[model samples]
Target: MRRAASMGMTTPTTPVAIDPADLAGVFDRYARDLLRYCTRRVGEQVAEDVVAETFLVAYERRDRYDASRGEVLPWLYGIATNLLRRHRRTEIRALRALAHADGGARAAEGPAQRATDRVDAERAVGRLSAVLAKLPRRQRDVLMLFAVAELEYAEIAEALQIPLGSVQSALHRARAKVRAALAEGDAR
Candidate 1:
């Protein structure tokens, strides 16, 4: 190495390369949750693709990630949420169908007491989806990231790249709409 005084100008240090281990850690921690969230939003068939693509995108952009800002799971979730947006119509249609399906006996759940619990759970999910489908896309996204993903308001704001106040406002509106819908359903 040349002496600083002799060289007059010190060469800049090389940029740090992203470690593969970091990405691996992210994948290990978040892949299952990402897949589950995607499946909930878009169904099982395309959830895998969405989650795979999410990790690929995260890996490619790993250098830009700011660990100081937040955790990897929210970032992965944001990516998965964006991918799910492309399949919104498919999700809405699928939810609509599910909401309307008669609680028929399934191959797995035989006509036992257990099936009753399963059917009740399915109906609850179906009703939730039917209500979710009616929400504005932005409001729905904010709601899901908060309610389904169980993210904090700050995390949702960071993940969605929106103001914290906007996240709050959207969540409030979405919750109100959902409560209204559920109440209306109860009356029926």
Candidate 2:
């Protein structure tokens, strides 16, 4: 007697074709990062809405995507950054929120930790936030892309439409200000 063959067995899996649905999945995967970036650049309250809008805009423009350019993260970042720039007031509000929240209950630390440590960390964050606010838009963008988004310099240059050298310079300047602020706090 011959053994029964499997009815649904396949030789090998074929590469699935990419469609709008696949593109949507990509958007979903990157949405959290985009939202975080927007929240940092703008405010948490507006971040969800802004990130939704950004994905919508990206979806509309997806056909223009070039496969030769590699992954879509940099492209998404560029789009989000542009949207962030258009809403400067929202960005200011976000920074203000950071300042206000810095002094309040800590998120990661326990409630019973040393008060002095909390105060020192809060003060440092506040001073850094103030200095960050005073930076030029380009510098701030570079700093955020580097420190927060954790993108490489080339990726940041692509996202911000700046030269690699400019990315380096902006980061250097932002770092200098942050260091100076921390040092000043130390002296005091």
Candidate 3:
């Protein structure tokens, strides 16, 4: 007698197909956010290209996605991060420039009464840039994923395909360096 499928009966599972159309959904859902993430890391000019390349790669490798592993965003981030590594020098320079420019913009936007605050802010930016420049590439990638991308530790782990402990370690090391740099500046 044939048992009903729900009654602990074995059923043949069909393979799930990766539709090309789903790539559009990925783009629609993630493109703008990925653009912002890339822009923060690499500046506007390279950001667009990076994002475009990310989606192109994603589309090409769509079949490799395994739902059991994690979600699409982390996968996209991993791809983007790998791409960013190829442009590491450019990214570092852009970040330093952004740090300086952002600090000046913030200072300029403040009231005249806050001039002293502006000067402090600018000094902090300079120190931060120097510290970031000195940080190891892995540490910087992890730190930026945490601070700029605002990814959780687990998300960072998944995106970088590193162990969670490694993520924590990298962040701790990065923060320690930044703090040390800031302390030196304070002592000056």
Candidate 4:
């Protein structure tokens, strides 16, 4: 045992010299952020799978990762975004399901305030979904990453592989469209 220990035969080889503990810490810290981003991009139901695939891909490609470039969050965001793009059909399906659920009229209950509040919340989310569907993919992505994922413009640009200016422009256009839709609804 002493000979094996001295020879380092019992030690497992990792891709890099970085300690596995450090890697685990990094994952723990960022996992929730990545999961939230995935949920917003796709839906909560598929978010777990997207996050698992993202981390798996990141691990496999760890050798090529450049730590000196910047923080790992943006790189991970880029990976998650790419995965989300592949599942656009699923996202559309989720949106449609939400819209259908929202299309039904809610039951009025005079006695229960909580039930009324829940119905109102669902109605608002459904309206938002309807508006979100009308946005171009890039614009919708930028809007969600900014508002839901709470990513900075530079991070959004990196994830979407767009210019920083494009991120700003896309968000501006997306917000304007959403506002116009809300205005039209109010007018009605």
Candidate 5:
């Protein structure tokens, strides 16, 4: 410890190792974040499956985790991302279903806005979901990682195995497209 301190070396914040058999601890630590990200990506329909498969893959490949790259959270996210790829059609279908379903109409049932405003707001939201469904896969993934997963740029880059600049570029393009779509929708 004295030798390390003499060299100005410091301990890392996150743990660099875990017992493979103690995966329950890992799951308890990260399942909520995974659930939220998965749910946002694929909706409640199959988010559980994605999260479960991610953990299963992680447990199966526990030895492959390189702590030097980053934390366990991002590693788990990377696994979840791979699983999400297989569910791309599921995501698109869910988004389109939301766009067409009246399930959320009651969510805006509050009397805050008049009937037309409520209808317009609902329509605008539907348009937004449709636009999200239409975003290119990489753009959508980057957007969801940043927006829903709340992963930092470097974390997202690590999770997706992309360059940091790619993460930034993809996020920029996604936000611009979403803004443009929303603006157009509002103008209607």
Candidate 6:
């Protein structure tokens, strides 16, 4: 090995080919679920790019995966979370934008007061979105992983690379704030 290094000649290690089937299997198993999770954060338009980058990163770092730690979904979510950080401001803006959105496309054309139910629902969602936007990043992440991704506390911890206790506390705080915001009244 030293002689080879000194001579700038490579040792003859067998090259391993990545199977197309394995890649297909991975994408098939998790793409839809990951897409839904991504869509909820960044909207449908940007979700595809995020998921694609996630799989690309996962494939590039395949050597780092440890099956003993947990399942693939959590790992994939972990990658998604890291990638989402780059879009954090985008998410906040989207949520704020959504809050201001009419939010009741199905309602019949009329003055805003005519659709009381629609107005109420819109306000409710606006409050919720405002609350979510105000949450600390860690708390929001824990909440999203648990609420949207349907991961358990342990899985959330693994995904976010945080302690289980931290996950529990962050989620707890997030829920409390949301509940309070929703209960308080309209977003206006």
Steric overlap count per candidate: 0, 0, 0, 0, 0, 0
The collision pairs in model 3 are none
Ranking by TM-score: 5, 6, 1, 4, 3, 2
Q: Model 6: residues >4 Å from true position, as ranges?
A: 1-21, 102-116, 186-188
lDDT by residue for model 6 (89-174), tens: 99999989877766555344556566677766876777778888899999999999998989988888888899999998999899
Q: Which candidate is the best by lDDT?
A: 5
What does candidate 6 score on TM? 0.80
Q: At residue 89, give the lDDT of candidate 6.
A: 90
Which pairs in model 1 have colliding backbones? none
lDDT of 2 by residue, 28-122 (tens): 56888988888877767777878888878777876665534445677778888888888877776566666666554563465656577676778
- How close is every model to the real structure, measured as TM-score? 0.80, 0.78, 0.79, 0.80, 0.81, 0.80
Off by over 4 Å in 3: 1-18, 96-114
The TM-score of predicted model 2 comes to 0.78
Per-candidate Cα RMSD to the true structure, in Å, reads 8.6, 9.3, 7.3, 8.0, 5.8, 9.6
Model 2 residue 53 CA deviation in Å: 1.1
The TM-score measured for candidate 3 stands at 0.79
Off by over 4 Å in 5: 1-18, 102-121
Q: What is the per-residue lDDT of model 3 for residues 49-89, given as tens digits with 9 covering 90 to 100?
A: 99999999888886775543435677788899999988889
Steric clash count of candidate 6: 0
List the global CA lDDT of all models: 0.75, 0.72, 0.78, 0.73, 0.79, 0.78
The residue-by-residue lDDT of candidate 4 on 48-164, one tens digit each, is: 999888888877776555544455677778888888989988887777667666522643533344466677677767767778877899998899888977888997898778999
